[model samples]
Structures are given as structure tokens and as C-alpha cells.
Target: MSAPLEGVRVIDLTHHLGGPLATMALAQLGADVVKVEPPEGDQWRAVDDVRGESRVFHAVNRGKRGVVLDLGTEEGRAALHRLVDGADVLVHSFAPGVAERLGAGAAELTGRNPRLVHCSLSAFGPGGRRGTDVALQSESGLVAANGGRVMPVPAHDTVAPWIMVSGILAALLERERSGRGQVVETSLLEASAALAAHRLIEEDSGEPLFNRFVGALYRTYRTADGAVALACYAPRLHARALTALGLGHLLDDPRFADLPSRARHSDELAVLIGERLAAEPSANWLTALDAAGLPHGEVADRPFSLLDHPDAAAIGLVVEVDDPTLGRERATGPPLRFSRTPPRPGGPAPRLGEHTAEVVGVSVGAGGGR
Candidate 1:
């Protein structure tokens, strides 16, 4: 079947993670996305981590044509407006006033193309000072909730892209009815809030137990040989886990009577469970947990080690790509599927200004005169 966004045209003036990733998702859904970069290339291309190359750029920017525009010049601004005039969507990651200064602000673009779905991906919501994903994590209480340990992944940055995609799609759907488009905005701060929505609750009784990761009965434990993550959130699962671990006698204990009671006495329960877990290897405990229908996982020694797991490959969760900068690489497939109008796994990311000539009818350097 043809992809869902077969005829959709997108003008992508985004950089770094959030905006580029969002526009890439649109391209995967078969939108004709034209990625516009400045003469210096995306800022991600120059990050210090990778030295000579950028896996960050390669990871998120795929299946889109590329164009170079020196938006600092009037020639570049004029060329960008020409592209945006015929586009169905325009997404940018400019700071609050940057877009207006560059002449690509939402009001101006939407006025030029009334049917355009204009999206702004920001570090913070409008009027807020710009911040990075790590800063937003600290501000959003995620770092504290994570026991002051910063997550290895930039959670807010990664999540903001998907949220932006959702917002753009929703706006496009609404435009169908109104015959006009509107601005759809999202920020890393907003994404951080959405990521921790469950924990953002208030209760007059007290602070809700934030134990999904650290609860005695729900956290990872060291087995005799390796580690295993166990989760006995439901009463039935708790009973089954206790029975499977040969600690069924704990079921009759008052402190372990129910969720609240068990939670209150979690340390005691953890001591009991950890002792039993330490008596056997992870394989043995995993087998027992499986038999009891408990939720569990074996902790891997390295991150992304499960990329080669058989089940991951079987489910099409993993895909292989030959990137120009990173060489052959293993990457994730599309985030979702549809029966009739499914998204296509895009090809490798384009090199900076790789399609400037084809996309703008001018070579990369000559694009300034477009």
C-alpha cells in the first residue's frame, strides 16, 4: 500500500535532536520532507562527542532531501519562502524570536500558505528561557525522582520529537475540516512533564509512593550469578512470586497482607526476597518467575546489547542500515505500523546539503542565489 503521507510536502528548518527527528518521522510516513540546513551544517554535526563524525545526526535524519540556505542573507530568506509557499507543513526548532528574525515565523508562513501545518519545536514553551534536555530533566524533577542519577539518554529531547510528530498530525487532521492550518507547538519542558505525568500527582494524604523502580518487590535484585528485575505489582503476582521463590509463608504475614501493607514493610520484604534470590542463579529464578507469570527481565551487561536478540529481530524492531559516516549500523525500525497505509523504513540519512541541487534547482553554493 502507498504510505499514508504520500503527497504531503514538508519544509524542515529544524536542527539537533527534537526538530530533525520529528521531521524524519514525517518523512518515514512518506512525506516529501526537504531538510534545510545553513551553510555551516547542523549544530549536531559539530558536537565534540564523535570528533570527526556525528552519529546523532545520522540516527534521526533519514529519508529526506537536503538543501543549504544561508538564512542570514536576503537571498536565502527569499528562497526559503518560495519553498514554504508550496509546502503542506513547515517545522522549525528556532528559539522564540529567531524564526521571526529569519522571516520563517509561524504567522508569516501560515499567512503565505494558509493550508500549512506550522509546528515549532522549542527548548522551552514560548516566553521561557531556552534550556537543554539535561537541564529540563532536573527542572522537571526527573533527576531527583531517579535518585539524583541522570539518565543516560536525554529523555526530554528524545520524547519531544515524538510528541511534536503527534501534534503535527493532529493539526493536519484538524486542517482538513477548517480548510486552514494553525500553529502546533511543543517543548522539551512539555515533553518532560508528559514523561513523568504519572508521578506529577498530588495527594492530601501524603506524597504517593514513587516505587515503580525501587519498590522492594518490584526492583532488580542480585541473584547468585547474575541480576534479574522482578515486578510483583498486583496481589496475584505477589502471591505467585512468593510461592515461586519458596517463600509462600510470607503470604500469611500481616505486614505483607496487601499492597499498602507490603509497601510499608517493603524493606523487610526486600531483605526476605533478596536473600532468597541470592541463594540461586538468575536462570533458576527466571524460570520460576516465568512459571508464576510474574513480570521479570534479565539485566544485560551492556546497553543496546539486546539489539541482536532473536525476538527483537523477529518482531522487526531492529533494522540494518549502511550509513556513509557510521558505516553499516543497526538501528530501530518505524515506531508503529498500519494495516493498509504503513510507514516505510527510510533509507540512510542524507549528507549535509546532499540534495541541494536536486531540491532547489541550484548547487549547494549557488543556493544563496535561489
Candidate 2:
């Protein structure tokens, strides 16, 4: 069976993670995505090594065709216009004003194709005084909410891609009724702020206690071998957690009887719980916790390699693709599944200008444009 978006064509003029990931999601749903790169190719092509390819680039660019065109040149820009004229969707991640300067602005393209769904992904939004400013992960509120006073991984970069895809999908659905495509815009900053909605609500409620570190009942604890995460939300589950650690007597203690009091003494409670958990190995503790109806899991110490995982294979989460230069390579599969038309993993990421002749009927030159 064909995919849901089998007839939809997308012109992907994006680079790096955010925009590429957004276009990739569309491709996974069966859109005919044509990735347009500059003469030198996308930045991710040579991200870390000089082998002229990066696994991270291939991971997101899979299931799409690639073509190179330097929009800086008049001839190249004209070629892009031709591609855009036939496309149903267009995605770009240029800095503020770059798209307008390159003649790919929403106004220009939408005038040409009223049914085109144009999606723009940026660091900051196109509104407010700081609209043109470059907003990095640190500047976004996500780092603050996720790290909680410390610098943790910037999940916004990964999450912003999904937000962009969601915006594009919504626009597509709206166009079905309105019969006119619209510009869907999203920023890393805006996406990050939405992700911190819960934290923001708690702060506005005047009960800053919700954001307090000590208020957590589920958190990381040191075990005999390594760290483990504990999550006991319900009062009964909290009792079960104590029982699992052989500390059932604590449940009867007046000072530790209720949720609020337990939170107030969380630091002392954590220490006591850690001491008991340290007596048993993580595997043993996990089994005991499961039997006692407590929620807990052992923390993974190292990154997961893709040699072969049963779950990944069973759920079709990973796919293998053959690359001419890199030989055989594996990458993450599409995130969605359908009953009638399932997503099909396409070929490996293209080499620089690999499809220039095929897409534009022209050859690639050093300075760009045939």
C-alpha cells in the first residue's frame, strides 16, 4: 500500500538538525521530499569528520532525494523557483531576512503557489523586539526548566523539530478546508517556552514550591552498583516504596505520614532510602520494587549501541541502508505507524550534488550553477 502523503511533494531547503528533522518527519509520512543543499552541501555533511559524511546527517536525511543549488546565484535561485512551483510544501531554516534576500520568502512563494504550505523554523520568532535576535538553547527557558539551576542537555533542539512538524501538519489540515495554504512559523525559543508550560504555571500560581528541588518524590537514588530512579506518586505506592526498602516503620511515623510532610523532609528521607537501597544491587532492588508495587527503574550508564535490540527490531524502530561510501549503515526509523499505509524507509542520504543532473537536468560546478 502507498503512504498517506504519497502524492504530496515537499521542497526541503533546510540545514542542520531543526529544519532537516522537520522535513524528515514529512518524508516519513510518504511525502516526496527533495532536499536542496548548497554547492558545498549541508553543514551536517562534514559535521565532525572529513570523510564527507556524518551519521547524524544521514539519520535525519534518510527517505529523501537530494539536490544541490546555490540560491546566492541568480541561475540557482531561478532553478529553486521551478522546484517550488511544483511543490505542495516548502521548509526553510535560514536566519531572519535570509529567505527574503534569497527570493524564497513566504510572500513571494505563496504568491506563486497559493496552495503551498510554507514552514519556517528559526532560533527566535518573527515577532517582538528580540525577534531577529539569535536565541540559543541556553537563552531558551527549556534549559532552565530541564536542568533546574544547572546546565543539562539542551532538549529544545531535538524537541523544536517535532514542534515545527506539528505546525506544518496543522497548516496542511487547515488548508484542506480553507483551500488556501498558510505560513506556519515556529522558533526554538517559542517551542522551549511551551515545553516549560507546567513550570511556568506553577511559578504564576505563587506556590513556587512546585519547582523546588526538594518537592520531588520521584528522583535518582544511589544503589549498590549504580544509580536508580524511583517514582512513587500515590500515597499507597509511597508506602509500598518504603516497604520495598525494608523501611515500613517509616510509614507509621507522624513526621513522615503525609505527602506534604514527606516533601518537607525529602532530603532526610532520601538519605535514609539511599542507605537501604545501597544494601541491594540495582537488579535485585528493581525486582523487589516491582513485587512491592513501587515504581523504579535502573539508570542506563552508557549510550545504547545499535548492534541489535529486540524491541527496536520488533517495533520497526531501526532500519538499515546501504551507502556507496560508508558501505552499510543503520538509522532510526519513522516515528509514526498506520494500519493501511505504513511508512517505508528510503535510501541512504545522498552524496553532494548526487541528484543535480536528475532533479535539475544540469551538472554541478565548483562555484555552483551549471
Candidate 3:
């Protein structure tokens, strides 16, 4: 079957993680995405730690064409308008007012392309406040979720991008009926709040929803070898875990009778579970847990390499791509699967304005020179 978005064209003015990721998703689904960068290119390409090269840029920008347009100049604005005339969607990650300042505002772009699906991704609510990655992470309570410690990764940055995708897809679906494109907006703050919905509390009368573990069942236990994360919330699975681990005596214990009681005495229960789990290798515990149908996973100490994993291949998570600068490399493909038209991973990221002439149909040189 043909790809769902095979005929769709996207004019991507986004940069960095959140905005790039949204366009990346559409690109994966077979949209003809043209990334419009400035003269020097996306500032992210000069990320200091990358030493003048950006692997993160390549990772998120694969399977798309590229153009360098100086939106700061009239020529740049004219180029954008020309591209907009033939496009179906436009996405950006600038702050609320930055687009207008650059003359690429919603009103201006929409006037040029009325059927344009304009997507804006920000750190806060639309037109509310500007925020940085660290600030949004802290504001979203993700920092507090770790018990006041900073997260090792950009967790909020990871989630905010998908939120933008959600809005973009919804807008596209609506356009199928209305034949009119609308503005789609999403923020890191909104994504963070949605992710923490379960942990949010109405009234904190000493019961912060995520301050502590509810029970010993939902935690990691170190065995003779590595550790395993066991999260069996079902009562049957809870009983099965105890029985499988030869700790069935706790089933009759009054303190462990119910979920609330088990949570209240979680400290005591943790000690018992920990001691038993440490007696054997995590592999042995996994055998018993799998047999009893209790949810569990072995925690990895190193980055997960899927080269040797059969399951990763089975799920179609890995794909081979040829990068212009880096040569052939194994990259991650789309997460979601489709029976008719699955997402097909494509070639490497563009070289600056590699496809400027082909995409814009003009004799434009690389970067912003010509």
C-alpha cells in the first residue's frame, strides 16, 4: 500500500528537539518535508559539546530535504512564501512572538498559504511565558518527581515533542473534512502535566501522591547478579510474586492484607523482598517471575544495543540508513506499526542546503551564500 502521507508536503521551519521531532514524525510517515534553516543553519548544529558537528541534528533530521532561507531578509521571506504556496504544513519551535518578529508569523504565513497546517511548539502555554529546557523540566515537577534531584536526561524535552505531534495530527485529520488548515499549539508544560496526571494531588494533607512508594511490589530489587524492576499491581500477581519467591507466608500477614496496608508498611516489606532477591541472580528471579506471569524487567547498566536482540528486529525498531557525512549507520525507525503502509526509514540528513535547488526550484547555493 502507498504511504498515508505520500502526497503531503511539509515546510519545516522548526529547530532543536521538540519542533524537529514533530516534523520528523511526519517525514517518517512519507511526507515531503523541506527543512528551512537560516544562513548559518540551525543554531543547534553548533552545539558546543558536539565539536562543530551535531549527531542529535542528524538523528532527528533524517529522511527529509533541506533549504537555507534567510527569513531575516526580504529575499528569505520571499523564498518562504514561495515554498509555502506549494506546501501542506509548516512547523516551528520559536517562542510565541519570535515568528512575527521574523515576518513568519501565523497571519503572514496563513495569508500566503491558507490551507497550511501551522504548528508551533513552545516551552510554556501559547503566548503565556517563555522557558528553557531546564526551566520547563523544573516547572513541570519532573525535577520534584525525582525527590528534588535533577534528572539525568532531558525527560521533559523528550515528551514535549510528542505532544506537538499529537496536535499536528489532529489538525491534519480535521483538514481532511474542512479543507482549511488551522494552527496547532503544544507546550512542554502541558506534556509534563499530562504525564504527571496520576501523581498530581488535589489536596496534600501529608499524602503527596508520588512522595514515596506505595508498596514493595513497584520497585527494583538487586539480585546476586544485576537488578530487576518488578511492578505487579494486581493482587493476584502480588500473591504470585510472594509465592514464586518462597515468601508465601506474607499472604496471611495482617500488615500485608491490602494495598493500603502493604503501602503503609512498604519499608518492612522492602527489606523482606530485598533479602530474598539478593540470594539469587536476577536471571533466576526472572524465570520465576515470568512463570508466575508477574510483570518484571532486568535493569540495564549500559546503553541498550539492539544489534544482537531478536525482539528488537522482530518489532522493526532498527533500520539501516546512509548518512552523507557519517556514511551508513543503523538508526531507529518509527515506533508505531501499520499493517497497510508501514513507516519506511530513508537516507541520511542533508548537507546544509543540499537539496535547495531541487526543493525550491531555484539556483540557490549551499548555506545562505547564493
By lDDT, who's the top model here? 1
CA-RMSD of model 3: 2.6
- Over 1-370, each residue of candidate 3 has an lDDT whose tens digit, in order, gives 6776899998898987778877888888888889998878887776533434577788788888988887888777778888888888888888889898777788888887888888887877767788877787687777786898777766667777788777778888899899889888878887778778786658847665644445688889999999998897665577778898889899789887766677778889889999999999988999999998888888877775655467777898788887655667777888788999987675677767878888777744346421
Question: 321-358 in candidate 1: lDDT tens per residue?
Answer: 88766678788777787889988778887777788888
Q: For model 3, what is the alpha-carbon lDDT of residue 107?
A: 87
| Candidate 1 residue runs with Cα over 4 Å from true position | 48-52, 207-214, 364-370
The segments of candidate 2 whose C-alpha lies over 4 angstroms from its true place after superposition are 127-135, 141-153, 202-205, 209-216, 234-236, 304-310, 364-370
The best candidate by TM-score is: 1
Judge candidate 3 against the unseen true structure and give its global Cα lDDT, from 0 to 1. 0.80
- Candidate 3 residue runs with Cα over 4 Å from true position: 48-52, 201-213, 304-309, 363-370
The C-alpha local distance difference test score for the whole of candidate 1 amounts to 0.84
Q: Of 2 and 3, which scores higher on TM-score?
A: 3
Question: In what order do the candidates fall by lDDT, top score first?
Answer: 1, 3, 2
Report the backbone clash tally of model 2. Answer: 0
